[model samples]
Target chain A: MTYINELDTPCVIIDLNKLNNNIKDMQRFASKNKVTLRPMIKTHKMPQIANMQIKNGAKGITCAKISEAEVMAKAGIKDIFIAYEIVTEDKIKRLLNLSKKVKLSVAVDSKYGVDMLNKYFKKANNNIDVLIEINTGLNRCGLNNLDEIYSLAEHIMNSSNVYIKGIFTHAGNVYGAKDKNEVNDIGKYEGNFIVKIKEYLETKGIKVDTVSTGSTPTAKISGKIKGVNEIRPGNYVFYDAIQHSLGVIDIGSCSLSVLSTVISKPTEKRAVIDAGSKSLGLDKGAHGISKVKGYGIIKKFSDITIERLSEEHGILSLKNSKIKIGDKVEIVPNHACTVVNLFDYAYLTDGEKILDIFRIEARGMVK
Target chain B: MTYINELDTPCVIIDLNKLNNNIKDMQRFASKNKVTLRPMIKTHKMPQIANMQIKNGAKGITCAKISEAEVMAKAGIKDIFIAYEIVTEDKIKRLLNLSKKVKLSVAVDSKYGVDMLNKYFKKANNNIDVLIEINTGLNRCGLNNLDEIYSLAEHIMNSSNVYIKGIFTHAGNVYGAKDKNEVNDIGKYEGNFIVKIKEYLETKGIKVDTVSTGSTPTAKISGKIKGVNEIRPGNYVFYDAIQHSLGVIDIGSCSLSVLSTVISKPTEKRAVIDAGSKSLGLDKGAHGISKVKGYGIIKKFSDITIERLSEEHGILSLKNSKIKIGDKVEIVPNHACTVVNLFDYAYLTDGEKILDIFRIEARGMVK
Candidate 1:
């Protein structure tokens, strides 16, 4: 009922048309590849958006934390996969409760994590499915090679309360790829690695059902590769300036932007917007996608650079500056995931009109 | 009360003892210098802490947004200053409504912002106080020269609905100082700038009342400078790793830290903590205070480097390699303000025991 112009500045605006196009594009890609799409909810963190993805033929939803899974489950999501390791008695207890409510699965890497899961699962007299998180050149988490993964898989299979579902890898390194070809190469390698691991596990009498792998950068290429049965790309739901820089998505495909108002014209060449690091987020062209050279890319003003960000002030440097005081502008942030997490509610829009406001239901679910 | 040992991982923990000491130290410094202390509430974002500052002789509270001022006003705070340019009609109306409830003042760097303010104040049939934001050296937002500031002041004085309160400057560049002496120099320059501006305005028949300037890095030196009548330092309440890096406060004086659990030990050199950019924030040693290198400084693990951050995974490069799975660790983030804004609630602690949970009441108040 409200108009976009009437909304406040420094608020998140999600373009509904682009959003649906992104969702349907990924869903169609998954369908054509014969892989189940289970979009990661960490990017959007909205249950309604997750429901949209599910309604668009997504098999389930992917979450990064137990609390995120709990939020989705509470919103009537039946199948949820917590793509994170849950350790400690407190979290395990919460995970057990969450699992009882929905068909929940978690990702694990170490014997320590598996043992803790087994302990809590045994106490509750319930069995839970788990995926081994394997790092495909991300060097962030997961087993380095098949040997280490096999050991963890054997340990999980030995446990009475834990079931080994499959292996999943986040090819986050593709965010650092040199070009589109490199991104596809990394995706191909990730899919091949998962197929190799699944074949090895089968030979060892450990049947692996799923080989879920892909990041937003590798989503298209990974689903096309054989043996990668599932794709869980989070940021593809709302492509960012970084993804656009990486040539993974078009600039027009970017669905999320911070609607900011020029609060100050400090100089002829410098203007200040209401959106700062707190709204647009402080991700400076992360993961080597450096085409867009600034804090964010200002729409329709290619010459304007969001040069810097304070806690609450965004400084824009301009060459042919037309920005004036009180002018409303939309900025495509470098990273959409962090920007989505920064706001309490995101205004859904259809470019010219406001649709609805979706509360970031799973925000601040770090624990 | 619960013991600190029972608290969850990836949670913000504030040392109450250290916090009290920080508040008292800043208060004593302000008193010794005969300058009014108006602690910026953007650092803590909690009304309880703002009240603590008030009880310790703080003249008022400074906020980065009108919504933050509104949050404090709802919690019964009387005197508040929003230190940012707000231009929209909706915000001006809210600001006018807020001024009615409290002694509210706002910073304006543009005539457009002031015109909007004048329009709203005229509609309400009320006069609102305003501070002219001037840039000493930060190069962010504010008037570039004394002439611009004087023109803005004269225009404001001509306006029937607004009153010129004073001038304010933020020495944010003090964070980028090469050494402590450089920081002092920046602080001194800030004080001198204020003195010159106040004197110039008075000679022009514009009476200047408050000369407020200070950032946490320059708080100790700026308040000691002559002619600086008021100091508004935010991060002094929760001294961060960057402040410690700048030698503004000792590492032990850092009151805010994110408590995290080691979730994965992938290699001898690599360990992953549950706290990542979502918990610790993605500041990356802002303002060029890079002495405490990495994403953050891990307490009691001097040899370990918080190498990088993913969304929910902090990759640690361990030299000594003592951290194990499920072991708890505390991290002092690079920027306390952003870290405080990340979580919904922060655990108040006495180092070893949990005292209370302070809800970040003004969190996500960017609008």
Candidate 2:
């Protein structure tokens, strides 16, 4: 409470109450679906926060990179799923080292990527549970066809240090959907695809256990598919405006915000704030009043569209309110995942008072 | 060069020849104008690169924040300018520390910010030079009128730690101008504006020594400005696609690029690359090429658009290019300033081989 306004502007603040509620929502939804929730810890890399998800009934934690998983493992998270491909020799070495330290599983979508993974495990004298990443609908990083998936899975099964444990797909394509029904329909299609793939692998005498499919927008609506045992959704931890826009979670459940001060009144229509791309981020822009905005929403000022942003300055324009220079504003950012990467630590608040501080320990761990 | 491809996909590559040439070109321009070229070191925070700038005829260096100045000072670059408003208490303390170590000058726009400088100098037992930042038209930050500027200058002259150095302005608004004529006109206006302010301060018995203004777009035709004694342009050190769009520099002068590999070849129309906002930033979209669709330019392949990006994946779609999964591609980002901040270091290359490894020492100095 003492350092509430004393701390510098353009600082990250997380409402612990809202954070707790968002956690419960995910846990309850996972329980209702009768699926184990391995909450993606990449959203809030802080140990204590990651532990909170476990306390709320998550089976384990999921991470995107080896460095992030290493941080979580060191912080005492034993079960971790690195839901990304460990492509290079150096990265595979990091993965092999991590597998020795914790219960680790990695996602692989390419034969070339899997070959490196198998070589690493053979070199390390160890093994990692491998998941076949499926394209399904998200045409980013995944297998294009059933033959490609089966061949990669078969190669992994034959490897001296690789285990084919599951198949996973991220319904990231749902982010650009039209409405809730569209997202739900897309989520069901992804679920059906994963279930069908599991059955196809089973018919081929390949025992498939984990069939995972999720994205923040789709995860909320994706109920129990016939074969999905584990759900790995990370952005659900701190759903932003983009999530709220897709009817994933309400703005009320949004936990994080950027506390900024009005620095300039460029004109009657435009007011520049201290936070810009450095704080708000140049991610996807939002409509209005999102759990977060591309940059951030000017708390109560929905008419203020963050049209453009430079690195150190956030340009804001208000349609109704007259916010003068020196006035402090709290903004919920668009994608909370990207926004949190900018800061070293976040001020944990409960709407009215500052309670604690969470170090963004996993910040700048790009490699 | 041993770890060249050992590095991950879609990372920053600084062409050393282009970098040196760009620096040389600016140096020659400054020399011809008979002005001090204190190049903005914040663009590429490599001490080695800063030294190169000096070796090529830079008078000193300019920093956007105190942390940048600190890094440059640690690297033994003595004379520096913190060209941003040092607002917070923590930063002012840093200013005092930096002042003791190096010859430091900061920018001040308002009477309040000036008072803070004055108070800090008096209390911290340190003296620092300050440039009165005038609003020539980049209304982002600076004093708007002469009376406001004069009052702040007077305050600085009398304050214990404050020393009035001169007047400076950024013709940032010139970047928004449509053509070279507007660029030249803005440069002339800024030059005259600074001269008038300098003369006014002289009449008030306050010495105005440093009269500087330079933004890359304006710097192109800024040779016409007679009263200006210095020009501090940052982006010219590494001309980007945006600068090329602005006609400030040729496309060949752009030094940095994202070295990426095609990760997914799902369909002929779409081939996803292992790079996204986490790699090539979602800053300004494309330039130079006819298509201005989104994100960055796909180097030799002008038709490909990196349309949508997630944290680690760039979804690119082109009807013409037959990009295989392992095929390598380079992307020239929309804006170099924001893209450079994402990495810890950049490999300096000569298009064919690695020249030097440069560390972005001042990556995140938000405080």
Candidate 3:
């Protein structure tokens, strides 16, 4: 068997045991809370891991784009939820084609999105189930006003082939939480607000089947809420520094890391690794969430800070450290989802032996 | 012919005429200065573009990794220089194997890297050319001391199958310059410093064939310096916002842009696009150079600031702009190199008509 240390530098490695544990833990949490787990495949972007999540009791998988959903569907994932608005004609056409292969549900927030979907679906004589997105603090692509939500839902219902499947919201604003208490408060509001939106839609003669809301930081708290039935947490499969900083997971629970080699010792206190922004990715929590201080966490050298990154080099600020050139170090990235998207393939290991190599099949599906 | 407006959103579009002009202008500048133009291919990572550079009079191509060199080599480029240190045995072996296919030379700064190359080359009964990397200004991975550089060159010369072909430096610090004057000063210093190192090495009985130093912002100034014979500029082929901010090029000269659609109009002052950090990479100069004000520059709406991004959503802070839902906007990314690595393919356009499509062949070659 091959070992991880024998592999090349600047490559991604997933601790298989930790990955299985993370998958099982999240699945168990959703099962115990009576919530349908639709883990977002955008985190791993690997069809094998998504199949494993399905084998461990995930009711469906959620994606950020239709291209990603198409990748999962081609890999035999039967149920897929595209948790984003489809407004453009090319994407709407691709979405209709994708709906023929799997049980697909897309997210919609505006009348423009609904009309685009209706125009295409009506021409093709096909129907698509869509989740009405509610704005619960993450004011990205969701309807916040009750009247707008009502009118959008009415417009979708009046369309020839569009139907309402559920109501969902991503409480991505919890990423800006200062502490665990704030995260808990945001999680409670996220769950209650989406459920309240579902109730209001029901009162308006629109039957919302699924009340979905989640992010990794708020998944457990939100899933446990009374009326929430679906939890779509993406980052829990390989919890990153952002999740750890927000008190969501421990550092040891992080399964994904970029195995890098120290290629240079420029000074007594500065070391350079072979991995940089191209491999590790430059994501420290987008949307001004600056809780993550550095680019990544060096596994055994917590005192060593990854100060900066070039295209192919990561500079480390060492503190009286004996890290020399040729020393191999594994880096836990600040954000796992973006890091995974940078590599073409990742190795599955069990801390000692390389178990298998899985292609990040859905990576760069940004069309 | 298909038109660019009919293409999908959140996709990369390259203006063919501007791209050709950029390539031709850089080549003309290098030729006029009597410097060998060896353009770095990490910016576009497309073999078609690299061939275009070759046709425009670039003597050779430069890459950050051996895998990228292999990609270019497979496309029948004769000469390549991997301007990064290769430390591990596996990579050294790959480097040696790649040398048989083309003229290959790599960079070395530390004795450890030279020793690693020496040990493998001796066993394989083969030799390879290497360039001594000097720390002109960017303290990422190069020797800064004169004594150490002499000792490392001595070590390489004394080895069984390692040869010194040149000395090089990348003045990447020009990205942090406050104004055009500072950039010019840094550029002049960058070219003079490497040429001085080459002269010093020659005085010590070591013959240096190539004195190479460059970055996009410094290439023109450095190439014009008296003794610098080679310049390697990667981003001038696309001339991103970082180059524009450094006053190296005008915004109209930028050839690369992400065609994104306004997916959501959250409020009158806030607009959301289909692109984000995934499409436009979060590289506002990696070493805390924050001269870039936003993620990218919108083509027509200069007042719209891309304030933040999620994985797939770019939130724009608009100023009473009429950007509505389903409106398409072209965004010039802050850094073209990292942004190009985010996609699998890019479309080539001539103003309004689609010319062709090229695969980003060497995109994720971080290893």
Question: lDDT tens digits, residues B44-105, model 3?
Answer: 99999999999999999999988899999999999999999998888999998898999999
Against the hidden reference, what TM-scores do the models get?
0.98, 0.89, 0.98
Worst 10 residues of 1 chain B by lDDT: B283-292
Question: Where does model 1 exceed 4 Å of error?
Answer: A285-291, B287-291
Worst 10 residues of 2 chain A by lDDT: A285-294
In Å, residue B294's CA in model 2 sits off its true spot by 4.0
lDDT of each: 0.88, 0.76, 0.91
Q: Please give the ranking of all candidate structures by lDDT, highest first, separated by commas.
A: 3, 1, 2
Candidate 2: clashing pairs of residues:
A241-A291, A241-A292, A292-A333, A292-A334, A293-A333, A293-A334
For candidate 1, write residues B130-178 as lDDT tens digits: 9999898998888858788889999998898989999999989887887
Question: Which stretches of candidate 2 lie above 4 Å from their native place?
Answer: A119-126, A144-161, A266-270, A285-294, A300-305, A318-327, A350-355, B1-3, B123-128, B143-163, B177-207, B285-293, B298-304, B318-322, B350-356
Q: What lDDT tens digits, residue by residue, belong to model 2 across residues A1-367? A: 4555666777898988888988888889899889888877667778888888998998888887678888888888889888877666766888888887888898887777777778878876778898888886777777748887788778877778788889888877777787889988988888889888889888888988888877777675554677777777877777777877777777878889888876556457777677777777776632111233435566788788876676777777667778866677888788788788777799998786888999988876655
Query: In model 2, what lDDT does residue B182 have?
Result: 72
Q: Compared with the true structure, what per-residue lDDT tens digits does model 2 show for residues B1-367?
A: 4444545665788888888888898889899879899887767777888999989988899987676788889999989998777655666788888888888898876656667667767886778888978888766677667777777777776777788888888877776666667767888887788788888888988888898888877764554477788998888878777777666667777888888877566567877776767666666622111323466777889888888777767778777887776677888887787778777788888685776778888876554
* C-alpha-based local distance difference test score of model 2: 0.76
Q: List the residue pairs that clash in candidate 3.
A: none
